[model samples]
Target: MARWHRVFRRWVLARHYRFAREALVPHFFDALTAYALELSRLGVPHAKEAVAALRELRTLPLPSFTGEVEDVFFSIEAQLLEHWGEEVAGALRRGLSRNDLDLTVFRAYLKDRALLLLGDLLRLRKALLARARAHFGVPLVLSTHHRPAQPTTLDHYLLGVEALLARDTERLFRALSGMDRSPLGASALAGNPYPVDRRRLAHLLGFAGPVEHTLDAVASGDYALELAAALALLGTSLTRLATDLLRWAEAGAFLVGESLAQGSSFMPQKRNPVVLEHARIYAARLLGGVGTLLALNHNTPFTDLNDHSTGVLEPLSELLEAGEGALELLWVALEESQFVEERLLSELSPEVMASEAVDLLVRKGLPLREAYARVKAALPGVRPETLGVEREELLHWMGLEGFFARREVLGGAGPRARAEALSEAERRLKEDQKRLGALRARVRAARFLLARGLEDPQAEEGQEGEVG
Candidate 1:
């Protein structure tokens, strides 16, 4: 087997295999081999004896075992019973079903994927920060109505992107919080017959708690729903960003320094904003995947196949892979394109700062609306109502003493808010790093046990459970 397969096999041998085997002790069920690896993890005392007995069925000198029913999960547990010296066949009998088991597996899988996505988030933040730092004071154009309105720092322009991504990170964490429950005891629809510890199963699966009730456990799929929604929002934000990049990086705008060129079969010169184009298309693709998932499970039974604790496993897998890849690639592109703002300045004239001018006039004692009209009339064109002032003078006037300070109030792009935002982002990075480190340790320990080829089926042990 490949190294990763072996490692995965080892994890299956330890935790997952043990749980499933314990869940199905009797070799009676046919589709149980799906959980055989977990059987090995259960560490039942009668395991070897059970294995011996099952082997006899296979090796019987009779035509008894006719149906080639899959039972590796239960059969392995039976085989290893002697080695464990104890058995939970009684408890396992009453409290679980394939439905709950599959949901529980999905929870575990999403937890792992969430951690992986955190890594992508880190790189994304880093990309934005690098751009901000490199172009901290580079002048660029600001726009509204598809027309340039005023000038601003190039790095200041990227601040909007940083703010959006920061919001996405917040949304991601909020969505993840919704998936913290376990549904192990919610067998099929009602629940298992036994008083098997549902909460304990949750603890075993690294969940925050049991999912309240049986039906809710089996039927609840809000995690997938909310995650898809959040992802859609994120995709939309990405598309907006892509839109800005594509529009502002035009040959005419010349606000982005890039040699995005390649020869086409028929054309002599085919320089294009390929990076921004890819980002735009991929953002659409991301949104589409989320939409597809929603449609796939809309009419399914409460605990139906299509839901699979989500719209469908296949689409989610695609979302995770494609979204992360596109974001990562964008990070590289973000770091490359230097912000070229001279053309941007030409487009976004001194009047885009008209709001600041209005604020200035308002402070000078004019009514807000009157100040706005006064500044509007004094500033620019027939479309904007132009004033013939020198651009350099207006630029300085825009950043005049009171203007910068007054605008910095709270969440505004004032110096203080920018600093506070940066600090908050840094603090979150540290907290997430600590959490990520713990998750890696858990995954790595799992790998370590598998590599040794020496694991006894057992419940999960880590900081995740209330009980070890």
Candidate 2:
């Protein structure tokens, strides 16, 4: 082999194999065990010894194999052939191909990582919820188009962020659901001839069920794409939040804890919110990875191409790992940072409450356009005399608390509306928590069954389990 070819085999291929070793190899062996037991049940030759040999293989340390082929599956088979001989290796390879096995392992690996990402996301959500509750009714100026538009409570802004993340949570769950099916029995993009029970294989591997179409099982990379896209969407939301926090930190309306902030080397007064900056970088990497994955899948044949399978795994895994880091940093920033309430109130433009002033004139029978025009005519200062209202009433309308008080309509910033919104947010948070908990429980149970099956290949036969 050429030097670069040898290097590729030694580094790139070896790295991928190591990842497989850590994340999916055990699951692959579990599937093989299940297959052997199924073949034994069907009285296939060599099936009985295959199971014992696989049990022995699992007990030994996985050997490192960097054969000239540059394929991890081939390397594994080579090891099996060398260690367990032809009869056992051939028996396990019966009706199996690298195409199906690789895809199955990829799916299993993605599912496991997705669960971990989901856990990180849930923690971030919980932290944001708690922060929202803590800052309830604390006033701040809401901005649009980079300018102050109105007054809103800190909790209201945080809740809006939570709502966006809530949608991301649903998308993640949908992606996980898309990946729930096992592709184990689809041998080389075609249905296997052996009487192997596909559903049993899925059960032993913590999958919800088997993919129905054999070709689709191996050919479809849409599940990985869906997950990447969901992570990208989540990255967008986090980027926006990070941007907002950066702005707030710059304005001194939010304080990054001293431990989280980085001081300038030369500038005496500079304290950079590097935590948010790093979080944004991680989010950008996620978005970039999504584009790379999409481009890799583009223009490729849809039938079990390496471009869509092994090719996307590294980038996808990096995206998930980056997302986890981003979520953790953001959660820490949210929990540890403090809002400068006095600075927030002091920095608000007095005219931020002008919308309430507009509403006041409309309530007195002025047309909406006329009320808006009258408020616009007041320039930067809306004095009581200029607006033809008593000073006391005008002051009340222009005050932040009064501004929030009068907007009692549904979804408004008024106390009643804010209270209702908080209650609804709390309800949604609790429901999401419950749903995540249930999903985690299902995964745990399925993993338990899979481990037990590995321990004794026949132990989980005829047992029922489901995971998604």
Candidate 3:
């Protein structure tokens, strides 16, 4: 019983408290400085000394506290009092509440995680582009409902996968959009009494603007849910791709590289696609995390509470980490895996082109139903030469290479269409890279300013201009 209690306390109770200290204390110290500076501007006595003390204390290691306190802020408060004396350290909490501080911490955590996830997604997309380009003309059968549906090139298939992930990337950006606002000045579900410059705090924190409503800012859990939802969707995408790769490899249509495969201990001929299997498991965990987070927040009072705090947010961190791992593993798997061309062609199932054969007959002035009926009346996997068209015409309509040529429409799995799509994807990736670079620069500038104490509290405009 004692062991069980210890396990629960260590794993469940104090885990996020530790996480908060490590992940949020640095950001909190900067916020504390901003609050102190604001208090000074309001003619609060000795605020500068307190702010200076807080800035100096920021250089010290994060405080380690016993498990008696479930919240990191209390531990931080204790540490501040010990170092700065009562008078100076007391100013740290002048116009802020644990509520507002928590909001900022959670937002900052989500913002950083979202950006990191975005970076991983971008790299995965880049890997897909590389694979697509490498196998530009490699033909394979396109599957629908778990069966061969049509002929398509490997590059075209990879481009389609990239398109799905591109949208996932956009959704991640949308999650970041929701996190762009700062919740610093929303003190305990109400506006701070001190003349605080929320916009300046937001700028210092690398947020685009301030969340206007104090109550809404402190109470909102929708941003976390949105991010979780997006991450779950990304996990879904990875799962589908992983499942397809696994199925193809199992069918001997795709070959997993030895670098990515594992051999069983006793099974001599085993070449297991362990990476893909692990990718699938990671994807499932991401989805399961979403469910856990949703349930944790469900029916809780829609206000500042422990339920939606660090503990709830911790699962999201796990999910995002899992998501990043799944993406990276799948990217490596895709990059190393090869298509068994003969096996791929053999599985094409000549009957998969029966519809195209019917289309040929229709163009020759037969009714749609009549064309389909005539084609169906014939034996399964009928030779294209036996169709009511000239040999050259039959090849044009039903041959693997010719099938791709006929699909010249935009977004089609044809040579020209895929080439154009690949080029466009590359261009978009370059643009996204620039955007990410700019964002990181802004964050670095904010960290730099925070580390050095604010020289002029009123220099908001200049400082904001320097960032972004």
Candidate 4:
């Protein structure tokens, strides 16, 4: 049983340890420094020794440890005891608990990961906008329920995708903002009795501020859930884009580049769109990760349970990793893809222009249902003469350029509306870029404070800038 437990520890719990070492350890060191400094300021005993030990420990390589130390927090404490003796270790941990410390580390780690994912999302959006601009007025047959429904431009379709992703981007930013508060001073499930300054701890660790309620700080997994929800929405948007690209590629209206294409092993002539396929697969995995997170947090007592805390770490990390992969794959796919203009134009059959024809008849003083009935009866071989319209007028309505020109309403599929929409999309992209820059700047300022072990007045002022 002892041997079995050791193997289980090595195989099953190794990732958790690695995550702790890689993602949480640096932040743990910073948190310890912040706490020691706060204690020194408050005239706590042994605070000076704690500070001195941490400074030296920072200079040396992080000590290695065996997995038998139980968890990352304990391992760090054990190392502290081994290296600096109980006086320094005990002083630093005066009011600290794994519950609050782990929560704080998780938030810090997630903030960095969220920033990276935001950058990838922006890159994908930029790729989409570039493609939309290049194919502004190219004609394509828009479909409803897998049948040709109307005529639209390639740019319009691409912009629809951009709009979806734009919302996903907004959601992700909101989630990141929601999780920005520090949870460091909420020792265990209640507020600690020590006079540690929570706000100072927040500043040193790069958080907006400490969470107001200590109980809520330790108990709430809503922030993690919010992030998972945002990722799930992003996955949905990516899947839709991939699905459309796959369909269009199969229909010969989209040309997948050789670099992104793959040849089937047995088939001699197959340029499969493997990038899009892989993107969709990654999206699926992201959604699955979100589901796992939801399941972990479901129906459990919400007071500092592992179900909502440590249990969520791996799933959330997987979700972020999957989201990153999907974003990158989609970006590359979009960059390497092209609209087959000839194929797109060829696919726009006369039936696709039927909606415009019906509108033309209604404008010619015919009742709506009567005009629809006339156009319906004339189908399967409808002609201008059969519909009792001038040959030139029917030709104009059926023409792709004329089809785009006549529907000049705002948000319509007309060229003018599309141009307006494109301009608006460009403006929103710029605003989003500015917002992302501010977020990154604030995080940098916080890291600077953490590294210096003292708050800079200028850095604090800079961190005061709001993301909105």
Candidate 5:
């Protein structure tokens, strides 16, 4: 019997029991309370005994049953049976199954994790905005295909990156919102025949409401997949941003602060921008995590299968943690770094103003073809005055500052545009904070109600009676 138990423990429970206990215990207890209330409402003969068993189960240390049982649910079941006997313990199983229970706990666990990831994203966005403001009006030649295409302020680049992260924030929120509905009443693949108030369970469990379809509630893994995809795209964007920072660092266009730089052991003069490199590597890992999650769910059965179970989702939280770390480190790197004005200015060739010069020539009644030829021929020492325009009159189309001012439409690189973008981002961030704050508050309130039920299920019963 000892050997048999050992083998069972090793084969089925050893790997995931810790995570299961941590993730499911509180939700399981709450589910038990809900079940007890539901049974009492139905006037079951042994509802009080079931409630007593739930109280006993809560007092027992979770780790004490480490190898004594295969899973927490099973452990709780055995403990309840020992304390309240089969008649009372059996009542606890009426409207719940591991299928729905696992999904519900997963939802609770994922809600907290998703909120943490959102917090990290919000912090990263703020960091990016700070960098934008710090570098406002600082000119840098924007590149396309490794060639200088146009001139833009450094803040414009920073805000553009923030815009990408804002989409990631939205996607994370969407993924979180998808998890709002509860799956607690969807026992196994269908649902229980017993009278169960799924809405009560959802309220107690911090879910917004009960998931409408019993089968779909147990079957769906799309929330996890969508979150993975969104995070993957977020990593892709961060990788691109890191790549740009790395290239600019290499070209001497940007300088990393001493704290963000690493030195080679063999080389005395090396101050490598390894933080950005680490960011790139972390982004790659996030993408890999996304691919793994997708593949895990791709060919699997839809209903409460092993592939879509709680154990399968254990590493997903780590992926989110990794993304958070990557975003934070990259944000710090950007915050600490400074652009090299001389080096950036050195790369700005007079030919970069060729487009504006072409437009001016067209205004002077020159043919487009002739204007293009004229601009090309006068590349090295090209000035607006050389093209039959007054020096002061043409000054508005000459340098990097003029180049920025010329594109003064909304969302452009001009000073006013960047200022407006910054103000708008601040407004959006305030809104996001308020929205997420409300969500956190709701979860907090739900948990408080659950804790009260754990203390005295009758108190919860009275409240429910008043509501009903």
Candidate 6:
């Protein structure tokens, strides 16, 4: 029941407590306090044991529990490091400063969080791929400027989203691997003479090795910032996809699949694309995190600036939350959302067949521009076969024959690439699944920023070994 000021003064701030309260407290502050004890353990072999024997009941920083825990810490120090209460307290002038410790801990924590975020992103990719598979050949009309523009399959569209996500998943892994080195050995920007085994600490923390440069280790939150940027980008892409679906489905013409909507409070006929709308808002907010982090580093040293840390919570929180729910939600939406053959068939105007018409004119010995002009005269808004070409052979010769056939180029909207992309997406989804699990393990070791609904994206079908 002690006031914060009294607790701060008695246990934490009687002396040498020259730090901001805000910086001193976070979810991981207790971890840092335990880490300090671990350091004390190095100098005093039975220090931790003695403290435990004192019935402290915990080994973490707790001003609230200071009556028990701090007394134990004192007892252990007196019995082991100190001369049995003769030298109860003293400050060391050499070795690592708390600043260095902060740098090291956060570097470790950020690496873990990045891995977790990566895993969530991977789940999203799998969900998208599964949706893609179920809808590839299912026909739908592609819209440009919110109007039906061309014939496209659901799979082709999802493939574009999948490709972007695949790249994002790769970026996350690269960030994690590159940033997974331990910074503990860097102590105070110069190596300590106490012979502390940095690599041993790295091993304890599951890092590949100690960071190479002490100064660099102290200064680089760039890895986390890069990860933030990447996550934001990935979120933006997912949001974009979601935003499109919300718009398309709301239009009512693309009602090939059942609507993932709800009635409004005031109106009965109001089926809102609420999730997509939220995603759109969150995507922008996630993008803002990147900007804020960048600006935080702009005025300060590029190394682990506190400003960089402070500005991240808003964007990162939004991104994680959005990914957790929006991903699974959209996957379900994509799965149920059917491709309207009528909407697609309606797009079959001869003007959509214009490209083929020009080709027909060219084959007929007309100049390319003349052919274009002739076709231009034919279309303001019309689908393929709606053009003047009555003969299928003429249209076939012109290459507007089949929507799928005309798109057989190397990376065009060909069924093969669409199928291939979906397969690749599925394959990558598995990689993501494995990667997601791995990343989640890493993050759980660091913090509690785990998101929701990341699991079960494609659980209805056995997608474990089946994406690519």
True lDDT of residue 366, candidate 5: 99
Per-residue C-alpha lDDT of model 1 across residues 1-468, encoded as one tens digit per residue: 233355545543333344333332222221122122233234433333333344334332221211222223344334334333345332233334767766766665665666677678667777776676666555565667877655545555666676777778778777767766766667787886543455544543445677887887777676777777767777787788778777766644533325543446787655566777776676677687666767766776775652344335446656766667657656656766655645555654455567766665565677998766767677463122333345554455576343445557654555676556566656766776676677567545543433232232454432321111
- After superposition, the stretches of candidate 1 with alpha carbons farther than 4 Å from their true spots are 1-96, 251-263, 303-311, 341-344, 355-371, 378-396, 399-406, 440-468
| Alpha-carbon shift of residue 341 in model 1 (angstroms) | 4.4
lDDT of 6: 0.54
lDDT of each: 0.56, 0.79, 0.78, 0.80, 0.77, 0.54
Could you tell me every candidate's TM-score relative to the true structure?
0.70, 0.91, 0.91, 0.92, 0.88, 0.72
Candidate 2, residues 30-128: lDDT per residue as tens digits?
Answer: 667767766666667677677777666766666564445455556656767887788767777888877778888888778888888888888887887
Give the RMSD in angstroms, all C-alphas superposed, for model 1.
9.4
In model 4, state the lDDT of residue 345. Answer: 62
**What is the lDDT, from 0 to 100, of the residue 382 in candidate 1?**
17
Question: What are the C-alpha RMSDs, in order, of all predicted structures?
Answer: 9.4, 3.9, 4.2, 4.4, 3.7, 10.3
Instruction: Write the residue-wise lDDT of candidate 5 on 1-468 in tens digits.
Output: 453467657656775677777666877777667667666666666775787667667867776446766678888888777767898888777767888887777777778878877887788889888878877888878789988887787888888988888888888888888878888878887787765677766766677788878888888777777778877888888899999989899988878889989999999999999988998888777787667777777777776363446545776877777788788788788778888866765667767767888787888899999988887776765665557777666556676666777787899988888899989987888788888898999888767665555433423332233211
How well does candidate 4 match the true structure in TM-score terms?
0.92
Residues 1-468 of candidate 4 have per-residue lDDT tens digits of 243366657755565677677667777767777777767666667776777777666655554445556667677677779988887788877888878888888888888899999999999999988998999888888778987788788889888999999999999999998789988888887787786678877877777888989988888788888999899889888998899889889988788889999999999898899999999999878776667777787787878455347669878887899999999999998888888888876657777778777888999999999999999888865577779999888877778777778777877779889999999999999999999998889878766665556654643322221111
Candidate 5 residue-wise lDDT at 398: 71
The predicted structure with the larger TM-score, 1 or 3, is: 3
Candidate 3's displacement at residue 446, Å, is 0.6
lDDT of 6 by residue, 372-393 (tens): 8767866664323543456656
Question: By the TM-score metric, which is better: model 2 or model 4?
Answer: 4
Regions of candidate 2 where Cα sits further than 4 Å from its true position = 1-12, 68-70, 306-308, 452-468
| Candidate 6 Cα deviation (angstroms), residue 353 | 2.7
lDDT for position 354 in model 2: 79
